[model samples]
Target: MISLKSPRNSAQSNVSPPVKLLGSALIALTVFMLLAPLVAVIPLSFSSEKWFTYPMPGFSLRWYESLFASDQWRGAIANSFIVGTAVTIIATPLGTMAALAISRPETKGRNLLLLLFLSPMVVPVVVTALGFYLFFARFGLANSYTGLIIAHTVIAAPFVVITMLAAFSRFDFRLMRAAASLGASKMTAFRIVMMPLILPSLMASAILAFITSFDEVVIAIFIAGPDQRTIPRQMFTGMREEISPTIIAASVVVIAVVFALMATAELLRRRAAAGLKG
Candidate 1:
């Protein structure tokens, strides 16, 4: 090793070991915390015993089989998908428009507008649920699919707005003007130039919003009826009624699906960033 007499080099060399140690510790702690519960759940799901007993009670996939066999579980999953998709369809376009408007250089009161857009995220879910219950009851929408969809959209829209705003902040708006000058119409410029640039961010936002609606329980409970029952709402009721390994199995499946979607979104983001740089 070569010794560096420069003060900056000396300071960096002295700091490196401690920084590495701290980073390693943080990574290890995070991994353990995330994986520990998952491991517990997996074993519980496979346990041959009826109850949640640790130790070696043998293992089987009976809980998973039961989960698949149950019509209520299947219906709940379908309901979640319907709710998630509906919320995505509503939130993505509106959020993207809001993000575009707020990101404009000449936009006035942008901070206030952003606050308004993000208020749903800042406010407690229970508060939103309560407010929606009261409002929808007056409108005779309570316990209807429309009410559930609207409630989920309200909660999910802020996530899309925030994600798109982060993506839009680094964009070059002059590109659209250049496209227009190059014989592209206003719509063509937006379609070809802006859409490609923001596509990954939009996808990420949509996926996040979908997952938010999928896992949401508070608003679902307030607005959803038997016909509109979602996976999270069913899971909450099931959890309150009894503790079953089937619940853990269902949770594992949902977690795995969400993890896969998020992983795909992250990969797309990385590719988008690399393409933008190159």
Candidate 2:
């Protein structure tokens, strides 16, 4: 019997520990740089001081209380949830359908279609917002909830399409064929076989779409009316005009919500992977 090691494996084994340590250090530093702002703002949200400051005299929930108590903040929260939910509902089905179409071998102009769907992500957000503003204004959709939802869906659908496309790339088409051979209708096969396999990815995509809508500011600013003010828009207003600790509290709340959504998405991803393996 003869044993052989690949040249790549041998090369990797020869790499020094110091090189790995340097890489690890660099990654840690990058993560710290990204999280630094959140770490600073989170504590400031609990500061007893009325204004933004560090090493507070004492910790207090007064700002959080103020955030909930204020009508503006409450309305913004409501609007954000409304728009985020609406965007998720609208974007998910459209994105999933687009992903399915593009993944099909028989589909024509798949690349072009994908490029169109993902163009929102490539173009500058301000540019996309300006375009939506101008387009919606002509239709009397400016300053309307419908306008805000449509604008958000344009951006968020791409995330769904991309996420599902990745999942679809790994999907086994044989199961759908098996279902079809078993006399299942096209819709029936998709509902029973395809959907179960893709449900986790769908859920993760929906969460991401909702988060995208919730966090979006530029389009919301251009399209949302005073009545449709979202949390991010409200926070922007606070930063420019009020400069209160309540904004910090709102930031903390937003951060918490984002982390929770991300955690859910991660869990769904793991479940999807496990199902595929099973």
Report lDDT per candidate: 0.87, 0.93
The number of the candidate with the highest TM-score is: 2
- Each prediction's total of clashing residue pairs, residues at least 3 apart in sequence or on different chains, is 0, 0
Q: In model 2, which runs have C-alpha deviations exceeding 4 angstroms?
A: 1-16
Mark the 10 consecutive residues where model 2 has the least summed lDDT.
46-55
lDDT of 1 by residue, 43-121 (tens): 7888899888878489789989988899999988899999899999999998998898899868898889899989998
Residue 208, model 2: Cα distance from true site in angstroms: 0.3
Error of 1 at 21 (Å): 1.1
Give candidate 1's TM-score.
Answer: 0.91
Please provide, for model 2 over 12-57, each residue's C-alpha lDDT reduced to its tens digit, 9 standing for 90 to 100. Answer: 8898999989989999999999999888778988889987766688
Off by over 4 Å in 1: 1-15
What local lDDT does model 2 show for residue 149? 96
